[model samples]
Target: MKLRAPISTAVAISFGLLVLLGIFIPDLADFRNRILNWAMLLAALALLLGLFNLAQVHWQRVRGREATVYSAALLVTMAITFAVTLLQGSDSANAEWIFNYVVVPIETSLMAVLAISLTLAAARVFQQRTELMNMVFIVTLLLLLVGAGPLFGVELPYFTRVINPYINNVLALGAMRGLLIGVALGTITTGVRILIGADRPYGA
Candidate 1:
């Protein structure tokens, strides 16, 4: 066990360097692709393990004497969904129906709830803090919500047609881009750390 750590670390760093070098070297691309495919298989296995762990936890809850309805429902739904998807294939009409009817509605409902929750949270913050950032957040949220559709069946041209598009296309787009840039930088930093053996999430 003690000897294994250095070996693992060395293997990890070697693979990392190879993958990085493969980008500019055409000859190494095939090797890189092979390594990536192996990584992907590992990732899929990890995901399967995660699902099993989740189901086990929920199953435990379902077996317990207290408040088990939600857990039972979740387990049943997951089992049914997994079985159907596996049998029918993801592109099958049954799977498509399940996705469209079940998944879409659930996602839409969750989004609606999230929007309302965010607005309420913003309002609470504004009420308590009365800070400039909080005020801006609430005002921006209100404007976006009001501008989303016609109010009382009356279209507000200034908001719906103008401000809504501007906020969504310009301000929101810029913010999203900035976030993506930050994420990319963070990913690079993490990869570098892993390569240098500064971070060993793989128990190296």
Candidate 2:
């Protein structure tokens, strides 16, 4: 046997135990809630790690005199954002305004670009494959877009008549139900694996 036992097993066990405790023991609910809070705290730390990594990479680029202009801009933007966040606090009016006007607009633009790229990619897939799955996907996407859009004057009969209602009520509800079921199954499986000492993700 290897000197270092796999850390994953320990992680899986802890996760499994927590999952079961959350589900079965109502009195242990507070423990589960605390665990969730800790998880979120850890997630925030991970985000900080990302910011650290970004700064490190840009600093190295600046030092090496490669793409120094872009590096400097990144550094400056990060510094300004960090300072504003720290001084005014993340929840303050100034921070909110910066996030709303600057960050939200940039994020929206990026999302739009990504959506366009995805559309092109999907179109290419349909062109290449020409399969039933691709046809179904394209049709579903078109239906979804038309149903969601505000086409006031030129109302398509099929969409306005049948598909819209079906999607809004039946499909949406069904999707949510499916998602809940999947989550439950995943939790159960994870818990079982952890209890059995078979699936440890943490180094515990």
Candidate 3:
């Protein structure tokens, strides 16, 4: 009774697997859509729980004066975003304006900063001459960056016509697709582990 976690996990896994098998099992089709809707509702609830948890943690940090300014900014951003979302009713012009101006620019700036940081780190790795993989990585990185940008790819009419297309479309796209597939597989594996009670965060 004290350690029946595996049994509980097994029961939950069996129920979920039966629902999931509805995709291929014709007999389960009647319940499939209902089960999926329930799953989606649960997922939405989980997201709200996450947001509340985030707010709580940041509020605590603000009260403690640990990185108070950043925590305050985060809370303010969340409040404004939430208020706008509710007031504008999701599809309204004001909601779109907030998303386009406030959210998009912040996200774009973060991505730009990330790219610059990665480029600098790659450059530093190249300077060390430590491993063959580092050189290969740097070469691939440079090709993708240049081939995707106007600096060398689009500006040069020849590259825009031939070289850039081959590098960006054929090579880079193929690599990215492969990476996405790997990520999907990894996600499936983790989900399976959770179902099987092999990954037991709930027990903790």
Instruction: Report the number of the highest-TM-score candidate.
Output: 1
Q: Write the per-residue lDDT of candidate 3 for residues 68-157, one digit (tens) a residue.
A: 999999999898888988987878888888899888999999999998998788878999886878877787667656656588334755
Model 1 misses residue 145 by how many Å? 5.1
**Backbone clashes in model 1, listed as residue pairs:** none
Better of 1 and 2 by TM-score: 1
Model 3 misplacement above 4 A:
143-191
Model 1, span 89-192: residue lDDT tens: 99988888889999999999999999899868876897899878878878888899899899999888899999999998999999999999999999999999
Ranking by TM-score: 1, 3, 2
TM-score on alpha carbons, each prediction: 0.78, 0.72, 0.75
Q: Candidate 2 — what's its lDDT?
A: 0.83
- Output the TM-score of candidate 2: 0.72
Provide the clashing-pair count of each candidate structure.
0, 7, 0
In model 1, where do residues sit more than 4 Å from their true spots?
1-4, 64-66, 140-180
Best by lDDT: 1
lDDT of each: 0.89, 0.83, 0.82
Looking at candidate 3, the ten consecutive residues that score lowest on lDDT are 152-161
Which 10-residue window in model 1 sums to the lowest lDDT? 1-10
Query: Could you tell me which residue pairs clash in candidate 3?
Result: none
